[model samples]
Target: LAVEPDIWFLDEPFSALDPLIRREMQDEFLRLQDILKKTIVFITHDFDEAIRLADRIAIMKDGAVIQIGTPEDLIINPATEYVAEFTRDVSRAKVFSARMVMRPLAPDEKGSLGELLKHDVKVQEFADQAVNSEDRIGVTDDAGSIIGVIDRQSVLNVLVGRESAGSY
Candidate 1:
């Protein structure tokens, strides 16, 4: 079927597929989104799939929307115990973005954002590189402007869940 609605509401589009095919479709869907950039109202019960596909996720239970947040926000600061339990087994480094743990650049670190990563990068994507570098990794904006910095320690904190609540 060919539809051109302004918004796409996909309810468990991959539910019936085998796990391998579902994963392949997930990858293909993500690739399509990178090009289409459509406003998609994708519905799924799989937390891992939701985390993988969403820029923001709205979780519902018993037909009521329970919480809404990015993957990192939901993982790092769940709104309730129910939400916490849902995120408990997620590898935080793979879920949290650089924006969640980055600090403002110190005076001595001016003009250094080019030395590291963009603010939107996932923490796990750069963890190894950050750990091996002597200085903090710089997070930048689309305009090539420095926004924040993240150190190996901060990245490690998220990996180990050592950061106190509300620290992000």
Candidate 2:
């Protein structure tokens, strides 16, 4: 894809899409990135999406970068909590990979639980599902390694229950 495009600028490629399709496109975009690591200058007004895709996100203001860093860096040490608050809405467990959050699964750990969501997907995504499952949700890397397990109940408490209450 990169070799063909001297420069590619998609103007809100998913802007017109319905929310569900837009989401599908976002996932598709991530999948494409695996095969083509292009230097892209994707533009979007959505902070959540920007942080999701960017290796180094530049939060722009008035035609300049107000801050630029990896998602974790920005979240943990926002230039200000304003940025932190913006990031807080995004579930770190979902957006970050197993490599970022996972401890090595013990050798004795065993069980073929059902399919877990992608490690790259936000934990907030699993909040509802977690509430229903008594067992831990497996976390896997892109290489398909069973790196860790997410405590389902914990995710529900953080992403839904506490999060909604904290917003008030």
Candidate 3:
């Protein structure tokens, strides 16, 4: 990182460390990436680590690339059975966003919508709030304009893995 290269290829950079140290290194890595904004190709057999650090992941098997996509994309629509099994244990709410679970706002229900959440905010971030609210929570875009709504059922669906990212 001292030379400021345009890209970095890290293969199990923290694999040798203890659990606590590995987590700290991962945090530090994220902090450095935020400041440097360098493109990174991080290779790891740890799926959880991949989900935490990668914007896009390519799943490979026996030297063949199986699928490539964002964490959300891979979680929601895995390309093959292997991909599905690979991500089956992941928490859906952690990977899905408000935009991915929200329903389109009806014209008559616009005025009744509850608190607004950003489109990219993950379902896990607001699950408790949404579940406790009686009214449907509104989902907003970058401009803060309401584009959709998420009800208690929607939040529950995500928590229970009954909601599909493509359903919204």
Candidate 4:
């Protein structure tokens, strides 16, 4: 980072560190990346780390790339059984955002929208609030304009794996 290269190729950079230190390093790495905005090719066997660090991930098998996409893509639509198995245990609520599950405002629907959630907020962050509420919660974009709404059924569908992020 001192030299400020345009791209970084890191292989298992924090694999040997203890869990706590590895997390700290990951945080520091994210901070640097935010400031540097450099393209990074991070190689790690840790799935959680890959999800945390990568904007797009390429899953390889036997030296061949099997699938490449954003974390949400892989989670919502696994390319193969291998890919599905790889993400089977992952929590959808953690990967999916409110925008992914929200329904567009209906033409005749006009009333109080209740509490609003940002488009990029993960389902896990507001699962309880959404599930317990009788009315749909509004979702907003960067400009704070209401773009869509999320309901209890939508949140439940994600938690139960009955719906895909792309379905919306």
Candidate 5:
């Protein structure tokens, strides 16, 4: 019988597979997630593997979701000491994107610099752009008004952990 369901609740389905095979299955599962758009309830003991797959991870302690969120939410704001320790091994740079660090471009700001840097572009991606540019890029509001400016120096400072980096 052909068995296909809208929602798949897999409980340690790949537990017996070797690490390499398990990784392949995870990739296939993610591909399915992209196409099917179904709710998945995947159970796993490996925290790293869980982080790699689940959209909204629900860390269970005593059969309850201690915390539930995307990987960022779990990393930035861990629920308990265990969760915190679990996320500590993860590299911050790998998890954080450029959009998180990028400031907006402001209007009435006459500069070709800002025009080149797109919103939510990664710091590393923007770093080269910032270096090549001459004028300071103005961070604009939703209404196209100048709110902040991102210059080569500012971008550099933010990337190297010297300055506070975040989204607007």
Candidate 6:
């Protein structure tokens, strides 16, 4: 019998397996989702796993769902101490995008910079590459057009906690 369901309700389905095998299964499952396009209720105690696999995570504590959000949302704006504690070790630069910290460009600066990056590019991906530059890194939209620029100071403010990513 061919068995296929529209939804996948998985409850620590990989918990019992060896770590290596579990990782493989997680990769395969994510690939399967891309093909089958099914809604998955993936329950995992591993926070990293949840971050990697789930588009939206529902964190439950004491049998109650405490907060539900995208990984970036939960990490940047933790609803409670418990949520913060869980995401405390996560790397903010890896999770936050240029759009999260970029400022709208002034008219005089449009398309002026010789180098540009996408607005949706993750901050860490390009932050280091532009550190030696004298000016802010220009950010572009999908149409290869400048939309905003991420100043070095702004990126530093976010990384050093002088400014909150959620505030932008």
State the C-alpha lDDT per candidate: 0.82, 0.64, 0.89, 0.89, 0.66, 0.81
- lDDT string for model 2 (104-148, tens) is 456665384555656666655665666677766677868877777
RMSD of each: 2.4, 5.3, 1.8, 1.8, 5.3, 3.0
Shift in Å, residue 139, candidate 4: 0.7
Q: Going through the candidates in order, what is the number of backbone clashes in each?
A: 0, 3, 0, 0, 10, 0
User: What is the Cα-based TM-score of model 1?
Assistant: 0.84
Residue range 1-168, candidate 4, lDDT tens digits: 688789999999999999999999999999999988999999999888998889999999999999999889998888999999999988888888999999998755537677899999989999999898887899999999889988899999999988854586
lDDT of 5 by residue, 75-113 (tens): 777889978887676644444444455455445555554
Q: Give the winner by TM-score: 3 or 6.
A: 3
Kindly report which residue stretches of model 2 are placed more than 4 angstroms away from their true locations once superposed.
1-3, 6-36, 91-118, 161-168
Worst 10 residues of 1 by lDDT: 110-119
Q: For each candidate, what TM-score against the reference?
A: 0.84, 0.62, 0.89, 0.90, 0.61, 0.77
* Candidate 3 lDDT over residue span 130-149, tens digit each: 88879789999999999999
Superposed Cα RMSD, model 4 = 1.8
CA displacement after TM-score superposition, residue 115 of candidate 6 (Å): 3.5
Clash count in backbone of candidate 2: 3
Residue 148 lDDT, candidate 2, scale 0-100: 74
Q: Could you give candidate 6's per-residue lDDT for residues 8-96 as a string of tens digits?
A: 78899988999899899999998988988989999898887887788899988899999999888898778999998988877777677
Error of 3 at 76 (Å): 2.3
Model with the higher TM-score, candidate 5 or 6 = 6
Show where candidate 4 strays beyond 4 Å. 107-110
Worst 10 residues of 5 by lDDT: 159-168
